[model samples]
Target: MATIQFRLRSKANKNVSIKVRLSIDRNNVFELNTGFSINPKDWSETNNLPKQTTPENKLLSSDLKKLDSYIIENLNTDLGKSILIDSNWLESKINDCFSRVVKTDTSLLINHIQHIIDNANTRKVKNKIGLSASTIKNYTLFRNIISEYQKKIKKQIQFIEITKPFVDKFTNWLINTKNYSTNYAGKQLEILKTVCIDAEKNEIQVAPYSKIIQHFRESEKDRYIQTLSFEELELILNVDLSNIEQLNQFKKENPELTKNLSITPESLNNVRNWILLGCEIGQRGGDLLEITRENIRYNGKNYYIDLIQQKTNKSVTIGIIAPHVIDIVENNLPKKIPHQKLNEYAKVICKLAGIVEVVKGTKLNTETNRKELGNYPKYELIASHCFRRSFASNYYKKIPTPILINITGHSKESLFLTYINKREDKDANADLFMQFYEKLNKDKEPQLKIIKSGTND
Candidate 1:
């Protein structure tokens, strides 16, 4: 068993800092230096003296010695370093550590991550992978890719001692053999790098994954994932809410509401409200879902949604009541639910509203044939992130791009511009038709005035 020892370091100013050192031996060690903090109100330096001064300290006496003996017996290994610590030994050590310092079960990545993930089945992992899903998924893929490559190449190398060259070969295999996107292969390589970091912390110096600079194809300029036309956008906006069929359906399905439009409609008013909530607020899924009734209120006469963004950790006080968005908000008090449930609800609602493709990137316009577009009319590629993308897309087209970027908390224009969809030529033609109509009706009656926009008056 490795011991975690603590020590005091007194600086030149006579200020003391605590240092924690972890060591499997006197030779190999890692340390954490904690700086000083302000003293708490109730703690007294003199009053805490007796335990330090006398034999009254029971911690250094019996309990620590007993613990030391128990740990020594457990670690009575006349063993040499073998291939990555065997499962039984690793699990026992981790379990022992968990029992001793129970607060942080994941202090050591190798102990907690590898032992658990290596032994568990997919079902067990699916149930228990906490904030660790993204990490494990990549390593598991790397492991598979390596295994497959080894069989074909008849590599004279063991995977545990896999070198940088091997990693390069594996990455190439993932791209060429697996038919994976280079971007995805790059992501897996990055994840492999992290796993190597974890391995380093455990003193298992995995040869650097590779030395190759990551190469990615330039993303196409007009290869926008979103292609909503001006008419489609208008159809979404000018939907007749008082439709008798919707009312009848609402009466039948009292607790839930559904839409009838072929395109994405603002069905389930509350969920649509949340979708619009994401649109105007321009936050990641978690941040947008954190909005509550209190965070929204009239500041004199203007409405605002004020909440901390989840990913950026920055305060966002934007209006969800923007003219482009407000109609979806249901006028009522708010309710609280767990973040997970709310996120799940957002997913369900996004799909039900015909916005699923845009949310998941499961499908894209460029990927589909135009001839097949009608059958898959609602086949737009959407993702949970598409809310932020759509918000940026529309705002970039209608407003200043820089202002849109700032409002959405994007730090770079080029990175953000990728989210902006291209203008469809079909929509440009529609606007041209509108101009022609206006020209033809130059000397017309009030019937020519079907307003698609609001008047300042």
Candidate 2:
């Protein structure tokens, strides 16, 4: 049982603030300023409230009654037991009852992500304007993940509630329950932290621990690095798709294989040529797929594939030095295929070329909707990006590192090394160094012999 009443503290001629008092029991009591003001002349000292003689007084009295009813009704709920009866808490309750400064649906953590998504185009990062399509896609995914988390936990997550414990719980749910890889889970956590940090800039109150939340990920060494060997590339190039009759007969013999490759005899040659071109010039799938005949330029001695890389927006020129690659580029550059179709075609091509050696890798499991780690046939893991990786791995140390980095469009030598997963093996350079050292010594040998003979004489 509880009692709530409004009263003025001082009897003054001027307008005075109305205050609320609530008594839950004999010992428990709370009081707060209601922020409503009225002159004492308008109030009734006898009734301990505003008199309903005038229209203004009548409306004020009605509002007070409604406020009283709201307090009593909320006090009867389960949430009432957990609440500490104090002036500050009472003030919050009063504000909530009056719909003042309460958390709205748009202010929730989930909505914050949406707001970011909505304004993504206006936002800028580094030299580029707005978020990348991939970044927006990732953020959209993070928003959905957070929305699902809220539904599962049955609580609307608040910015103030994003503490260390909340981060730990969310991280656990992301990795263990959601089957997200450590690196992927780390990326989500990074997005969570970024959103929180962004919220702070907008004058939103976030828990201090949000800044310190660890984004966990596995090291590069523990990660499965996939690449195609040069021999595998050579094998794929040599797979003859010359005769339509032969291709049709092979397809009839292996219906499932042709269906999986989505192969047409005409398209097989085109996809194969693209695979070779992609490997010869190390570029991302998006940039590689978009390459046109107009991009191929010859500067007297060498033909170059010149373009501005989409990801970095930096210009790069990759020379087609290999005679076969040059010949193909000059005579026939493959017709463009869809990125997804190219990936599928590449795997089928690799498999047909006998690149089925079982190796440790990760592949997306459609059933689980995650990339699960296991030993799979090499061709099973092949994707469009494998060409870029294969190029880096195959040409490493054979070409000058700086030249390779420039062609690959890698900003740093260290990052390029991680991509190829190789160290500087200077065995060839060491042999060249030895030859130079031997030549210098040989040039001095005759002079040294002459000096020694003259001294002896």
Query: Pick by lDDT: which candidate is best?
Result: 2
Q: Candidate 1's residue-wise lDDT over 1-457, tens digit each? A: 5774444433233434434344566664655432221122212234321133335343333333443444345555524433332334433453464353322324332243454356434423324423344345655665666456657887533224446666767777877776666566777666555555555555553445322325454265414354333343444344444465754553455332222222223333444455555655667766666666667767576777677654444566676545655444436322444444444344434433343232223233344321121222232343346567667766664655556766777667666765564434457546766877898998877666566667676
TM-score against truth, every candidate: 0.45, 0.71
Model 1: weakest 10-residue lDDT segment is: 35-44
Off by over 4 Å in 2: 1-107, 249-256, 260-262, 423-457
lDDT of 1 at 186: 72
lDDT of 2 at 190: 90
29-126, model 2: which lDDT tens digit per residue? 88888868999989987877798889998988888888888877877763557866567667777888877655666558998899999998888787
Off by over 4 Å in 1: 1-164, 172-181, 197-204, 208-218, 221-224, 227-231, 241-267, 324-380, 397-402, 421-457
Candidate 1, lDDT over the whole model: 0.49
Q: Scored by Cα lDDT, where does model 2 land?
A: 0.83
